[model samples]
Target chain A: MYFTSFEQFINMNGHGFYVWLSYACFALLVVTNIWVAQQRHRRLRKQIKSRLGRSAKV
Target chain B: MSWFDNWHLPKWFYQMASPKWFYDFGARLQPWFAGLALILISWGLVWGLLYAPADYQQGNSFRIIYVHVPAAILGQSLFLFMAVAGAIGLIWKIKVAFMVARSATLVGASFTALALITGAVWGKPTWGTYWVWDARLTSTLILLFLYTGVMALNQAIPDRSVAGRATAILAIIGSINIPIIKYSVDWWNTLHQPSTFTLTSKPSMPPEMYIPLLLMVIGCYCFCAWLIMQRTRNEILDQERQSSWVARYLED
Candidate 1:
């Protein structure tokens, strides 16, 4: 096994800081991308709706 | 008869060019891909974090590979995928392809950013430096910029068709860098390690260590696929609102 105990595994021989930091950054990035993708979708939806609304009124 | 066929990409591309067809296809594919992605990720993370032996030299720090390598590979490949979609849309004038390209570029750029940042973090400890101008590193830097350039070009053109063509040109030209990025470490001696994923010869790490890396790579890819579908559906809806069917579909 890679580690003797759960605690040591979590500790990662004190390299946990780096390991976890890397993970944290990766998670943040993925989350942010998802958020941005959603935002883009919403923005495009609004734009399309507004365009349609204008055309409909005319 | 078998469900799948030999000419997979063409058939897939044809189906993808129709928004309604793409939407149905995405719906079918998304859940399966997402489930497989989640399963593989869970399996890989558990094995990598707890089962695989720490690197002899790097120790536990090497665990970052489960994330970094896949992010990097997908980061690069997704751009190529977007460019191809853009080209198809531009040449064939398929609105769905352009929409897919637009949605995908954003996701690809995001992944590329993640890869570069994660790499920098890993580099700090292993290389005793956070960033450097090594050939491999430099090429990847260029890749990030290329992704940015394509994105900006797509947005700058006022007309959507012109936007697609402009970005397609940039994407095609930028593709030259993918090969350069792939070969940078090999072509030049550098601080960055040589290829982690390979086809032949003995793997640098043991099976336990590499397996999770493999799973994470697969998961990253699946996640990309899922994200693209999710985002492209939104794009299609946005672009196709003028179609009478959109109202009926959205009503549900």
Candidate 2:
């Protein structure tokens, strides 16, 4: 409903490239954020699990 | 216990200081927000990009609104959130607040970058150049540098606690510039056009176009919030790994 079609919408008359590229940049940033979070989560999870085991033994 | 009735502000924030609380909270809320983010972003983009009619003058180039405006708004708003979070952590010495500040700093940087890049692209055909040193554009560049400064401050200090205070101070002080960046387009006769979506002023465009724009902006904001929660939770876990609750978390 935002537009009629992807191509039609992107075509922004003749400004499709700019609009689409701007979106490309947007997508890039979002994906990067998600990736960084996931990576940190993995690292932290491992760290917490390891520390918990050592503390338990101690 | 329901997450609602039991929630008290002080205890709630204090509990959030625990990595276990953050992890559980993030895990619990992730699906809801993820779904919301997906739905809003999809519906909004579809409406803005497909349903909305192209502008008569700019033709299709005006479609950049779907991305440009939302990113610009989120970019500025995210920095404000960072400054607030940083200030709270600095004043209260709350570890969770600091983590949230750190997450927001990174997110703000990314959003600011997206805004400038998108704005430049949108400028080329309309303004007859890829970039112009318009007042708004120049101020936005400064905004991006401010984001970098916060990020750099976070990394520079070796001590985590000290770094938190330092970054928080910088973020809060730098926040003063946010309003300036926002008004630059308005106050100065800048090359950048004024905002399409305004509160008091009636929109010049048709409902079809404005509707999509509204959707995109809302969806993007939700997406940013969800991402911040996830990142902040990660930071909390990293910091509180020595705690018993973290041990309990690992057991799960």
Candidate 3:
């Protein structure tokens, strides 16, 4: 609301790069943490299921 | 049921310390924490980026505090949690405690890395240098190295229980660095600023600024809770893969 336009909001009186970069890096890291965990969980589940299926066939 | 069943605390503690019980409890808790994290993070980012007034002194460059402060606080607290969990595991030989301690390393390392990155980026604009070897900064760097070392030590050990015992010792010893990092600015002539929001004192910033910051800190904690739960659950699955419960749970 402080800014009159989108450009102004992004510019932030010439500090836009630092401000935006910090936020972007943070957002990326947080998302990556969750994503990596979810991926690991999925892989573990798949491994377990496949192992169980193989044992059942034997 | 024994007489202890009459007391909820011991019963809950015992149950909660079991891998199956903790896994089920974490499964239920993770989504709620994730939901709160998303809500609070969005609210804080929006408010901090758009509505909050720019600092009169630092201008919009100061806005980085929204991320920096929260990450720094979470990073430190996560390390503390790792140490305490490590201590419990060492003392009790509880599998759940060891799992929790092991689960904390990756998340704690990531957060510590984030804190350092954000601090360096914020320092560029405010302090005119991207990095400095100030006491707080140096100590923080050491903390990050300690986390990395613990992770490396765990991975190098083939036996799970032995690795847990070794890493737990390192974690406890490394915790000594935490207080030094916290009080670095107070103890030494450093470029880093003193603490802003302390438990014993009124916040230095106004409500408008501190409110968003508060929300962000809470959101970070929630995110940590969610992520740690996910890692802990994965640890349980890995450790208990041959157990009947995991097989049954996976079947569904």
Candidate 4:
């Protein structure tokens, strides 16, 4: 609403590149951290489950 | 006699020391924390980027503060937290404390890096340069190094206990840099401006600008809490794999 039009919003008075770049990097970092944590959690659970299966087989 | 010998921690504190208890508690609370973070951060970012009026002087570039300031604050706070957790582990020999300290290191480092990059991007437009050798910047750079050093030390040591102790000592020693980072702008003739928010005085910026910033900061902290808890739970599962409770947990 600050800007009159969507183009102006994206332009951000010609400082758009810098503003959006910083935000993009921040968003990427947040997503990557969450994804990595989730993956690690899944992998650890899988490892434990496989170990449980192997011991049970013996 | 040691000063803490007569001191008794709360019952909940003792319960939190148990990895299985913490794992279940974290799992229960994790969704709330994550949801809160997502809502707050998204709201703050939208309000800050699209709705808030631009800075009178620096214009749109100042918007970077929304992300930069929160990242920097958390980066430093998390390091200090890591150090305190390390201290707890050292003093009480609590295994869970060590795990917390370990989990904080990676997250802290990522935040520090985020702060640095965003600061540089903001600087290019405001300060006319992408990088500076100013006291505040240099000290924050040192903070990033301290975090990485603790991480490397943790990976190098084979035994978990030994690694934890080693990293804890390093983290405590590195904590000295936190104060240096905090006071750097005041202590030296740095190009970096003084802090926007101080405890004793009101925030320098107007509510429209600062309110969103506050939201972002709180959201970042919540996100960090959620992330750290998730990682700590994984660590508990890994470290306590041989325990019967862990086996039962997996079964469920």
Candidate 3 residue pairs that clash: none
lDDT of 1 by residue, B219-244 (tens): 88888888888898887776677787
My TM-score estimates for the predictions, one after another, are 0.84, 0.84, 0.90, 0.93
Highest DockQ scorer: 3
What does candidate 3 score in Cα RMSD to the true structure? 4.1
CAPRI level of candidate 4: high
Would you give me the overall lDDT of model 3? 0.83
Model 2 agreement with the true structure over B213-246: per-residue lDDT tens digits: 8888888888888898898888777777666776
Candidate 1 chain B, poorest ten consecutive residues by summed lDDT:
B194-203
Pick the winner on TM-score between candidates 1 and 3.
Answer: 3
| Candidates by TM-score, descending order | 4, 3, 2, 1
Give DockQ for candidates 1 onward, in order: 0.53, 0.65, 0.86, 0.84
TM-score of only chain B in every candidate structure: 0.85, 0.86, 0.88, 0.91
Error at A33, model 3, angstroms: 0.6
lDDT of 2 at B237: 73
Per-residue CA lDDT of candidate 3, range B1-252, in tens? Answer: 244336545577678678999999999998899999999999999999998888877789888889987887777788889889988776655788888988888888887788788778877777778886555455667788888899999999999989988999888888976676557644653344454322112347888888999999999999999998889999999999999999999888
The residue-by-residue lDDT of candidate 3 on A1-58, one tens digit each, is 7678999999999999999999998989998988999999999999999999999999
Q: Which ranges of candidate 3 are over 4 A from the true structure? A: B1-9, B181-203
- lDDT score of residue B129 within candidate 4: 80
- Name the TM-score of candidate 1: 0.84
lDDT of 1 at B177: 60
Candidate scoring better on DockQ of 1 and 4? 4
